[model samples]
Target: MDLAVAHILSRVDVQGADVLLIDGPSGAGKSTLADAIVENWPAAEKPTLIRMDDIYPGWGGLAAAGEHVRTRVLEPRSLNQNARWQRHDWTLDAPAEWHDVPSALPLLVEGCGVLTRASAALATVTVWLDADDAVRKERALARDDGAFDAHWDDWDQQFARFVRDEDPVSSAKLVLRAS
Candidate 1:
């Protein structure tokens, strides 16, 4: 996490990065890394942080959420326009209220499926994080407190497809390993 923060700070300082994307397999520490980055951000104004968990419509919404961020958030921000996104109410299994992100400030998005080639191109910094499969599965299942138990295999298959089709690891500017 310290190394990731240092790398991101370096990019922000040297490249004037206004958009940062951190992506990884489930439970690979994307959320943890994002939290660290936000806490240690060097800028006077912190970037807006959005988690892909909020954007995903359901267990199978990874690819769709990625596209949503690309078209609604990253693309608009790249054009210097305000970005808007609708959160997914997981409990109700329906779309929820809209949220807006200011384009004038920096943005940090951390999630699976957010670091595809197109999205990476729009981002100032992109990261790919990975962990051992056993570790990731254990962490994810435990984090959700058995709520994700039923959907684990399904989610894994979908994420596998996303990884295969989008090749996020190759698209990322930085690739980090986590426990």
Candidate 2:
């Protein structure tokens, strides 16, 4: 973990990356890594963080969330345009309020579907994280308590399809192991 954090910080320092995308399978610690980066960010003005988890409309929205991040967020931001994205209200299972993102601030997006080819092109840095299936499943279940219990198999299926179709790992500039 420390080495990963140091490597990310070094990337930011050397590359002057303004948009960092951390992506991987669920329970691979993408969110935890994002938190660490933000906490230790060198810049006084921290990057704005967005999680794909918030964009997923439901259990099967992995692909949709990835597209949304590419088109609505990364593309616009790359062109120096303000962007807005709608969040999925998980409890209500509906689209929620829009969140505005300015291109002026640095951005950090982290979650399961974030490292697609198109999205990677827009990001200044892209990371792929992974872990053994058993470890990942255990961590994911514990992290979400019982909310994700019923959807485990279904979500894993969707993720598998995403991996096969998008091959997001190929788009990553940096790859890390979570456990």
Q: Give the alpha-carbon lDDT of every model.
A: 0.89, 0.88
Q: Give the per-residue lDDT of model 2 (tens digit) for 95-127.
A: 999999867777899998888888888888889
List the RMSD of every prediction in angstroms.
Answer: 1.5, 1.5
Off by over 4 Å in 1: 13-17
For residues 1-179, write the lDDT of model 1, one tens digit per residue.
Answer: 79878987788643243889999989899999999988888767888899999999898899999999999999998888878999999999999999999877778999988998999999888999999999999999999989999999998999899989999988888889996
RMSD of candidate 1 to the truth, in angstroms, is 1.5
Model 2, 109: alpha-carbon shift in Å?
0.5
Off by over 4 Å in 2: 13-17
